[model samples]
Target: MNTLGVTLVLGLLLGVWAQTNIERPQCDSPEAEEAALVAQDYLNAEHTQGYKFALNRIEDIKIYTKPDGDKTYKLEVELLETDCHVLDPTPLVNCTVRPKMMTAVEGDCDVVLKRVGGVLTVTAFKCKTEESTEDICLGCSTLLPLNDTTALDFVHKSLASFNNFNENVTYAVFEVGRMSSQVVSGGLVYLAEYVVVEANCTEDPCVPLNDAMAARGICTAKGSSIAHSVNCQMFLTMMPVIDANVVDVNSTVAVTNSTSAVAPALPPMVHVHTGSLSPKLGLRYHKLTTLHNPELSGLLSAESTESDEVVPVAPGVANSTAPADAGSDSSNSAEVPVVVKKRDVPIVPVVPAPAVVDPIAVVPVCPGRKRFF
Candidate 1:
């Protein structure tokens, strides 16, 4: 081939065309996607109790994407209250700022996609024309989002706190995901993205909700962090779902209240034991044992014979009974001498032994290795 032909072949190889290859789509700028998110968040903010007000024109949108993938956008939007009952806000069709007229009004809006609690949350900064000072929109709060940055020193102080089971937990940058100047709550509540850096997993199936939340692959502690708070086995017979803090009346209350008129009060109530007494129709349970049994009253009082008393005879003491003197007076004929060793006397009250309910009548004999002895 000629030099010109060689050049042509090289050109075709370098120039990948539409027919020879798949069409390459232009990579979307981070700013453009963030603008859409901002507009959607604006609609959500306009949502009221019964109906959600929507906006079509999100005007003059300016999107800013940070290094951490957080996004912020500012625009002007025109509110349009619709009949739709959708709880979530759909994206605006267009963001065109038209000249102000009687029916149409414009408001400045700040929309942001913030990382919060390991989730991305959309937030908007907007102020009503009535609330704003002149043309400048100060959003909802005068404090501004800069208040969150003020807490940075407090956040650094949290490093001293020992967190996690192994004490290997760390403090990370709690970036503000969403900040609202005005909301249902009067003051500003910064919904922040907590950078909880979980410990690195050295092995598979690592412990859940420990330093390795990544092991569980979830932030919630339903099954991961918390085990059963109450006895699972006791309630497992009837209770199906295990929701935290929710009371299941069927499993807990209906256990002892089959035909009872009202649900019995839960006990044993704290600090309520008054040691009260009852008699007659009022039933009471005495801790009945062999020692306290009413049926075995007769056997407890059986006179203690000399052998029944377990007195240890001391080597120092000598007990002797003298035979009647043959020639002495009748009253002085017999004399008994008792020698008692005196030490620190331990006063002991005599208690009779309660009779056994049933004596072992027969013993089972295990003659060989085949028997369970």
Candidate 2:
């Protein structure tokens, strides 16, 4: 073939390749809307802790046709927080968007989807929320609206921790008045200022005091998965003053002096036991067992037995009861005492017992013997 004929064939192949691989901007159509909906569903499912998001609008869409006749959709979509929480079984279409006055959250997502055998599948996605963007720009601390889902969650967690430590009264959260959050190296920290009222019921769905003079208190809580602290103060009326001294001069030179005394007392304050209770304290027990460490299991069991008492275990100190050798003979295994110590106690090293392991049974075989079943 001549060089001209070869050049013509190469140009034709290049055109076909470009048409197959090149992405084309597409107008808003049903296909684009369908892709956006699918992406929205994916986002809502991935987010399990916060309020569910509904598709606000499709920002942009690009379609690419592959050589195998498959199509790829690259989309940018806006999402708005809905009134329903993620845990709620309500569908995103049925959920209504939360208003801005209620601290509504909005997010934008870049989603990539591909159609294989006429089925749409999300290939990749990236999202950025308005709150997160602001947080990153502002750095560290950020103010949160009381009605925000995350803020409310922190408020509830603080109240729960407070109730767990409180001995006399079981209080219920009356209102989440104010909240702020900080991003730390360990986790997010929430500072919540709220009001609590004495509750008639003890557990969840608690009934607040119904009396006209029901006791109310103001509480401030700073908490995270890493640590928790709270302080609550109750209001009280001032006592009446008492006159203790009086002096009177007789006759025309009559002079009088009086002295009044009032009790100097501050309102009662409730301070929670910090660092003892966690938002996920209840779940830690299962995790400790899942670690499969006998020392941890023993420690947990001991802690449960003395749950009423606070025992500080030194960090970086291995348990004295842990087995020295994990793979050892079962017959030689022996029980060891678990030593619990206070924070200031000196570290002590103790020899540990060998771990128990089951022996495998071996099947006996005769040489040159053939068997059929």
In order, candidate lDDTs are 0.25, 0.48
Residue pairs with backbone atoms closer than 3 Å in model 1 (clashes): 58-95
lDDT: which candidate is best? Answer: 2
Among all windows of 10 consecutive residues in model 2, the one with the lowest summed lDDT is: 282-291
- What does candidate 2's lDDT look like per residue over 83-163, in tens digits? 554544556677787554434466656565778888888765555555423324433455564455666665665565555
TM-scores of the models, in the order given: 0.20, 0.37
Q: Which portions of model 2 miss their true places by more than 4 Å?
A: 1-17, 21-27, 132-373
What local lDDT does model 2 show for residue 7? 87
Model 1 spans > 4 angstroms off: 1-34, 66-70, 85-108, 115-120, 129-373
CA shift at 316, candidate 1, in angstroms? 94
Prediction 2 TM-score vs. true: 0.37
Error of model 2, residue 334, in angstroms: 69
Candidate 1 C-alpha lDDT tens digits along 1-373:
6999878854543332111111111113334344444554544444322123344443333222333444333233334433222221323332232212211222223333334444444442333321123333434323123234432222222211112111232222222111122233334322211122233223332211343223111011111011111111111122212122213322232122123334332211111111221222222111101121212121112111112332332321211101111211212211111101111122443422223111111121211111000
Show pairs that collide, candidate 2: none
Worst 10 residues of 1 by lDDT: 216-225
